[model samples]
Target: MTWLIFAFLNALFESLKDVFSKKGLRYCDEYLVSWALWFFADLVLLPSLFFMPIPELNARFWWALAIGGTLNSICAVLYIKAIKLSDLSITLPIVTFTPIFLFITSPLIVGEFPSAIDFVGVMAIVTGAYFLNLKQRSLGYLAPFRALMAEKGPRLMLVVAFLWSIAANFDKVGLENSSPLFWVISLFSFISVALFPLVVYKSRNFTGKLRRGWRSLALMGLAFAIAVSCQMQAVSMTLVVQAIAIKRTSVLMGVLWGALFFKEKGITERFLGASIMILGVVVMSLF
Candidate 1:
């Protein structure tokens, strides 16, 4: 029960953080935003490292964090690029399909075969998501299909989803031998700190954009750090796959935010889709 609450709170914060991030991107360069976000998260993680035991550091832990951190940076870069190139509506739904990839990968990678009902839930989410993306064109409701075919956003999102699932699964493996939240966060922080010098040296225009994007980037980094910490902690305490399924509930929350705050219209189908996906989440949570 406690884990459930933690998961939900993590999801909620993540959803809000994404909203703020999208808004921040309006005036910022994607690369700069990415760098800033990572930098600040590392800053937050630095102090925690001082308190952790030196003996706790092991080759397995370092390797896991190194690999996972590298992959996650790639994930962040792809996501930022996608957001810059396409509509949020398109990118989010496609990425929200992580469960589909995870569902398939979990059994193969970790040897955890999901139940038949879980597969049904996966289908329900995909169908609902697709339906929600539907738009009315001259051909009538072929909008989503046309948009997906025309835009790189959806494709990039699919790729991001696949990478995130792989990274997430490996994260579970890595966390097994690691110390508490501090070291986990510290490792992530180290990864980010290592990247900053390169980011600045490679991109001269980054600073100009940072002037405008810093706050947004920092907020995203902080929120993301907290969300990630909560999730990593939650996974440590429970099942990583189930933790992922619950976290993906952000899709439903994103839909509501889009409808209410962004005033994005023509999304009745998305609401229905989110509702169905939410149902699957509930079932997955319960059984």
Candidate 2:
């Protein structure tokens, strides 16, 4: 049950991160926003290492960090690019597909398999996400699928979701070998460093971009730090798929933010879709 609390908190903070990241992306390229995500998160999280007791690291921890960090660094760029290229409501909800992919990766990587009921809940969430684009159905029954294929953002986000499913299992392994905070700190550190060269290469007027967008980037970093910390804590306490299923509720909040902040349309259908996602989360959590 405590894991549920952390999971929900993860959802809240994760949504905040998405909103802030989307705002920051207005002034910075995906490369800079992607790098700043971990960089700023490291700024917020690194300080806590001094206050917390250092945990003993193992080979497994380092291995998971390296692999997961690489995958997530790639995912971060794709994710930011997705949001930059399309509506947040459209691209963000596509992440709900992660739980579906997790059904395969979790068992193979972490030896954890979700039950039938969990599958049902995952289906509901995925279905609800599909409904986020329900307006597309006006064109045809398969219009949503067609719309997804037509949009670069949703397509890239689909890749991010699949990669995340695989990376999350590594996250569980990393958590098993180290404390949650330590694992998050290490992972962020690795990703920030890995993306440094790309950020430098792809970004022009980097200092100016940072200077102009520092507030949003800083908020994005803080939100991301809290989100991942809560997420790792929840993951440490529950099955990876279950934990991630709960976190995917962020899509609901992302949709609302899209409506409120960005004035994106289709709110009626998206809200209905988000409501179904909430029901699915409840089923997964309580049953």
Tens digit per residue, CA lDDT, model 2, 1-287: 99999999999999999999999988999899999999999998898888999888889888999899999999989999999999888888777677678788889988988878887878788778768778788899888678766889989998999999999889888978987788888888999999999989999989899999989999999999899889878988998667877887788889899999999998888778777766676676567
lDDT of 1 at 179: 54
Q: What residue runs in model 2 are displaced by over 4 Å at the alpha carbon?
A: 1-9, 229-246
Superposed model 1: Cα runs more than 4 Å off: 1-4, 51-55, 136-146, 180-183, 190-198, 232-245, 281-286
Candidate 2's error at 151, in angstroms? 1.4
Angstrom error at residue 74, model 1:
1.2
Note the residue pairs that clash in candidate 1.
Answer: 132-269, 132-270
Error of 2 at 144 (Å): 1.9
- Local lDDT at 286 for model 1: 51
State the TM-score for model 1: 0.83
Q: Highest lDDT among the candidates is held by which one?
A: 2
